[model samples]
Target: MEFRVLGAVEATADGAPVDLGSRKQRLVLAVLLLDAGRPVSRDRLVDLLWPADPPASARGTVQALVSRIRAVFRAAGGPELVTEGPGY
Candidate 1:
């Protein structure tokens, strides 16, 4: 699969378009791609995905977003791109 993020975020698998899921999922991937090869903190992801009032389920929402993004990358035949570590 190939990912295009220099412009709008897009993913393709075997030359066919691959859906990355929802808008929030795409945003999560977009932010991570902007800082590719690095660890993006969960807090930062929360901030980017929910700038204003965050729901009580915000953490779960972020987790789901990350999982979906990871699935998209895997479906595109790419390596696990987002790695979580210290402060990330």
Candidate 2:
């Protein structure tokens, strides 16, 4: 599987295009790809998604979005990705 983040957030599996879902979902995927091999805390994702004023459920939303992204990757034959941990 490969990802294209230069123009639009896109992924391909064996030369077939993978649907990245909504804009926000694509953004989340982009962040994960941009920071591949590094631990991207949930808080950091929430901040990047809603820097001005995050809703009370910002973290949860990020989790859901990430989950959806994982599903897409899984369907694309990609390995398990996007692990969760802790941060201050």
Candidate 3:
């Protein structure tokens, strides 16, 4: 998948369009792109996605969100879009 993130999110796979709906999903993708392939920490993702107060399952939610975003990338014929480590 080749993505261009300027004012909005747009991704194409083999010259075909890919749809990644939902505001939260967009937000997650936006943040990751903003980081320019750098691994985004789980804690940071949780905080950024749900500010003020987060749910008890915030961590899990962030992970699920990331997984969904990665699925979109794969569907677009791209490699796994995100990587995790000790810190990013």
Candidate topping lDDT? 2
Per-candidate Cα lDDT values, in order, are 0.77, 0.84, 0.76
The all-Cα superposition gives candidate 2 an RMSD in Å to the true structure of: 2.0
Best by TM-score: 2
Residue-level lDDT of model 1, residues 19-63, one tens digit each, is 888888888888877787788888888887789977888878888
TM-score of each: 0.83, 0.91, 0.81
Off by over 4 Å in 3: 86-88
lDDT of 2 at 70: 81
Ranking by lDDT: 2, 1, 3
Alpha-carbon deviation at 69 in model 1, angstroms: 1.7
Q: What does candidate 2's lDDT look like per residue over 1-88, in tens digits?
A: 9889999988889999999899989988888788888888888989999999999999989888988888887888975774756521
lDDT of 1 at 2: 73
For residues 1-88, what per-residue lDDT tens digits would candidate 3 score against the true structure?
A: 7777787787788888788777777887878878876788888878888899999998887777778887787667776664658323
**Segments in model 1 whose C-alpha atoms lie over 4 Å from true places:** 86-88
**Where is the poorest 10-residue window by lDDT in model 1?**
79-88
